[model samples]
Target: MSALRSRKIKYFFILPSIIWVLAFTIFPLFYSLGLSFFKVRLGKPTHFVGLANFERIINDYKLVNSLKVTLLYVAITVTVQIVLGILLALLFHQETKGKSILRALMILPIFCTPVAVGYLGLTIFYEEGGPLNSFLMSLFGAKIPWLSHPTWAWVAVLLLDIWQWTPFCFLVILAGLQSLSEEIYDAAYIDSSSEWEIFRKIALPMIQPVVIIVLLLRLIESFKIFDVIFSLTGGGPGTATEVFSLYTYRTGLRFFDFGYASALSYLLLAIVMIIINLFFKRIRAVYE
Candidate 1:
């Protein structure tokens, strides 16, 4: 009886967390899943539509374009973040005076709110008299449109994402670097291995798991990028920066197409899941 009571008490302790997940996570997920199969619009009675919503999404031109843009954004941002982050991690990993201060400063951008970052990006990329253009004009007597031109607007969004997220990659890689076995490095040095060889042959292989984990996390987050694009460009300059999340938000909130929006969201979820599965498979292959 006492053992049963103790088990009950332990369950009581976890009840709140279970309830929270049920109410916020699991319930909403199921609700959205059901909603995706219905034709739900504001001021109209919802009707069962089976796979109609999914079919509509598959045929959606805006969704297709948003997918392309999102893929481009994710590819560019994640690649750049990984490369630059690894370089920065290596540079800052050395013990030097002021290294702590520099590391703290590096994380400031990541610590800022995404909405705040987006608004700050808006100011920086403002067309006529923004600081970037102003500096360029003063220096070269040329002002390139940063926010108004479609290509430049895409670049601005990309730049904002890179600035905000590169620090995350850097911090993760730095942690991996710091956790490395010092004795291994000592032995490598005793063997007269060059720094490049030490990193490429030893350090990188040891940190491969951390790097893969960071890439997966960033890829998932980058796919759901909405606040930054919403506030920075508003998917403007002719839908050039309309990512999947932003497109879904515009459809559901702005256009009141709940069913279709739900479908698009599920598609995004599926894409992320597929990418994560691939990463896991790669990790298994590497380890096995």
Candidate 2:
């Protein structure tokens, strides 16, 4: 009875969060799942369509294009973030003059919103009026169509994502570096290890967990990227930068193809789950 009473007391504190999750997250997820089976249209009767929606998605050219674009964006952004973040973290890990101020400046991008970052990208990359073009005009006297061409539009979006998120990876990696014991470094020095040998043999091994975590976070965040691309490219002069999220938004809200959009969302969820599982397996193997 005493144990039961203690359990009840703990349950009382947990009830609010459970209720909140049920009301907001669980409910919406189930509702969307339900909607995926019906042919729902505005001001029209929803008919059960079974797997018709899923079948349509299999043949959707635009959806395929969006998927390709989304994967490319995710791959490029995550790779750049991990590489730059680790380099920055390693650079700032040592004690030096003005290091504190440099660390603060390095983290500034993490505090900025995605929308603000996108707008800032516009200011820097805008074809005729931006600083990049202005500088180019001063030198070689030409402008780059950064946001107009389909290829360049994707590149521009990737740049915005990298600028805003590299700092996030840097912060996480830096924390991981701080958590490591200094004894290892001292021992390596006593053994007359070169700097490169110490980094490869000791530093990399110690920070592997942090690198995995940083890569996973960046992968998930990049896969669902919408705000920066939306604000900067609006999916571009064409469907060039139309990512999976924007594709879902257009289908659900703009086109009122609720069933199809829900199906697409679930498909994306499945893909992400698979990717995460594979990543975990790969990282676990490395640890072993």
Candidate 3:
């Protein structure tokens, strides 16, 4: 009876969180799933459309372009963040003076809002009046079209992502680095293992799981990237930077095509799920 009472108390404590998840996350997700299947329009009854929305998505060129851009963005941003984060983590892990201060300073960017970062990027990269163009013209006497050019715009977006999220990746990797046993490194040092050898043979393997998780998180976040691009470029220069989220936003809110936008969102969700599944499968394979 005591055990039962304890379990019931535990359940009662957890009930709020479970209810919150159901109300916010699970319920909304199912609602979106239903939305994906229906022909939804503003101020009109939502009619069941079977797989019509899905079929429409298959034929939509804009959705296809958005998917491609989103996938590319995720691939590039996630790779860069992980690699740079690991490098920074390794550098900071060494014995140095003011290491704590450096770590605290590095974590500042992670705490910054994405919208603020986007605005900062704009301040730096905006044409005619931005710092970047001003510097270039003063130093080398050359004018660069950062916001005007498609390639430069994309590079700016990547730069913003790297600046904002690298800190997060650094924190995760640094935590992992800290958790690694010092005895292992001491033994490696006694064995006359080079720093490269130590990193490859000792550190890499120990941190692989954290790396995988960080990569997955970055990948997912990048796919949903909107605010940065929207604030920076508004997916302008002729759909050059229009990623999936931005595309769907334009479709639904700007164009008011709820059904098509819903279809695009569903397709985006499917792609995200597929990528997540692939990552898990790779992780499982490595573990096995």
Clashing residue pairs in candidate 3 are none
Q: Which candidate order results from sorting by TM-score in descending order?
A: 2, 1, 3
Model 2 scores worst on lDDT over the 10 consecutive residues at 1-10
What are the lDDT scores of the predictions, listed in order?
0.89, 0.87, 0.86
Every model: Cα RMSD to truth: 3.7, 3.5, 3.4
Model 3 C-alpha lDDT per residue in residues 1-288, reported as the tens digit of each score: 134454568877999999999999888777777777778777242788988988987688877787788888888988999999999999989898999899899889888888888888888997886898889999999877888898888888998899899989999999999999999899999999899999999999999989988988888788889999999998977788899999999887887767767677777788888888988876677665
lDDT by residue (198-276, candidate 2, tens digit) is 9889988999988988888778878888888888999886999999999999999898889888999999999998988
Ranking of predictions according to lDDT = 1, 2, 3
Q: Tell me the lDDT of candidate 3.
A: 0.86
Clash count in backbone of candidate 1 = 0
Selected candidate, larger lDDT, 1 vs 2: 1
Q: Please tell me which predicted candidate would have the highest lDDT against the true structure.
A: 1
lDDT of 1 by residue, 1-288 (tens): 134454568877998999998999889878889888888779253799999999997688988999999999999999999999999999988877898888889889998999889999988987689899899999999988888888999999999999999999999999999999899899999999899999999999998889988998898889889999999999987899899999999888888888888888889889998888888887677655
